[model samples]
Target: MATEAPQRSQLSLRPLERDGFTARVLRSLTAFIQTADLKPGDRLPTERTLAAQLGVSRSTIREALQTWQAMGVVQIRKGSGTYLARDVRATSLHVPVTINLERQAVLDSLELRRAIETDAARLAARRGRSEDVERMRVALEEMEAAYAEHGFAIRQDRAFHEAMFTASRNPLYLQIFQQVINRISDAFNESRENPFVTEPYADESQPDHRRLYEAVACRDEAGAVAAVTRIIDFVESTLRHDE
Candidate 1:
């Protein structure tokens, strides 16, 4: 006697009609996985199907899937399909942060960074290796050089923060920081001119990055936290001033 193939579980996703559609799709997918009791290695519905179910564009589905892939929530194989990369029941996945050029959103993102990065800086000061400190130094130098030549060091500045996150010896911190940075970059790219990329902002912010690196290098945990706080506070104030 032949046995029947195992049936795949169905997902019930409602159409989203709100701003930040990509973020909402991600949240909806995460909720579905939990409510449906999806296990690791379980394949997800195709992008086409998900888009239809969510009443969103294929591109939106792809973007949300890509974000999940980055977070290690799902694994996408070309020609095959997307699958849950881990057991959602065991792991807690926060909804990835999304940003826009909106004033309040930008301020909220800065606050989020302040909360995460300050603690990360303190951890890095306590536990960072020599190599980790070296990475921060190199990134800082590159940022300074880039700013001198181009009047903007957005890429280099991001590199500096990434180095800091790595130094914290926490993979989750790096992952969260990358998601926030990616959203911020998208917001800036959509705008005609990125305020954060301006000379005035970069000039004001560069010293704080150096201070953060120095504090981490010296294993000054309190100083590290203070430096990170100052950097975020400056950005928040700058944004408020513009409004």
Candidate 2:
């Protein structure tokens, strides 16, 4: 006698509360995919269906789907529907840690950066090659040029620091920098919008980047550490004053 196939489980999503709704939605969707035994190329439910199931607005569902799409977890086809871009059975939905523009959180993030980056600066000075130094120079020059034209050099600034991390020649340092700094960078950007500030913080911080690059180029480990320390201290002082 032929046996019947096992029944597939239903997609059951709990109503998400207000706090961390996006995160909850991601978790719920992950659970639904697992329970439903979804595979790559499988189409997800309609926004309306997912919204109703999760007790959220269709916009919220769309936003979650868009985020997943960006992460390569899902693929959204215009006029068709969202489909799984990859098999999520062995994958966990990762929610990036968001740092609020709150005072303590900003300070804590800066402190953590200072601790890691000071050591990274020293390591870069010691281990960095000529090419690594050139990368820092290019990023710094681009940052200065962008700041001169736009009064903000967010991308170039990040690239400069990323170059520094790369120059450190430590994969772990680069990894940690990406994970921690990238997550909290939005908060730092938002903090610059404070109406009370006399000058653009980026302007004040520009020289520090150049100094850091110079130190690393010359292989002055102590100077590199000092430059990194000064940069963090200045940022901390500015934020503290704002508070």
| Model 2: lowest-lDDT 10 consecutive positions | 190-199
The lDDT per prediction is 0.85, 0.79
Error of 1 at 158 (Å): 1.0
Which is the leading candidate under lDDT? Answer: 1
lDDT of 1 at 142: 100
lDDT of 1: 0.85
Per-residue lDDT of model 2, residues 1-243, tens digit only: 996533443546788886776677888888888778788999998999899889999988897787677567899999999999987743543443445546688678777778889999999999999999999999999988988887777778779998999999886666556646655564555664542233377778888889999999999999999999988888788878777
Q: Put down candidate 1 lDDT per residue, 1-243, tens digits, no spaces.
A: 996643444447889985788879988887777777678998888999889989999999998898888778889999999999986642555467666647688677777778889999999999999999999999999999999998888889999999999999987888888887777677677465667767898889989899999999999999999999989888788777877
**Per-candidate TM vs. native?**
0.77, 0.63
The list of candidate 2 runs beyond 4 A from truth reads 1-18, 27-93, 119-132, 166-203, 218-222
How far is 80's C-alpha from truth in model 1 (Å)? 8.0
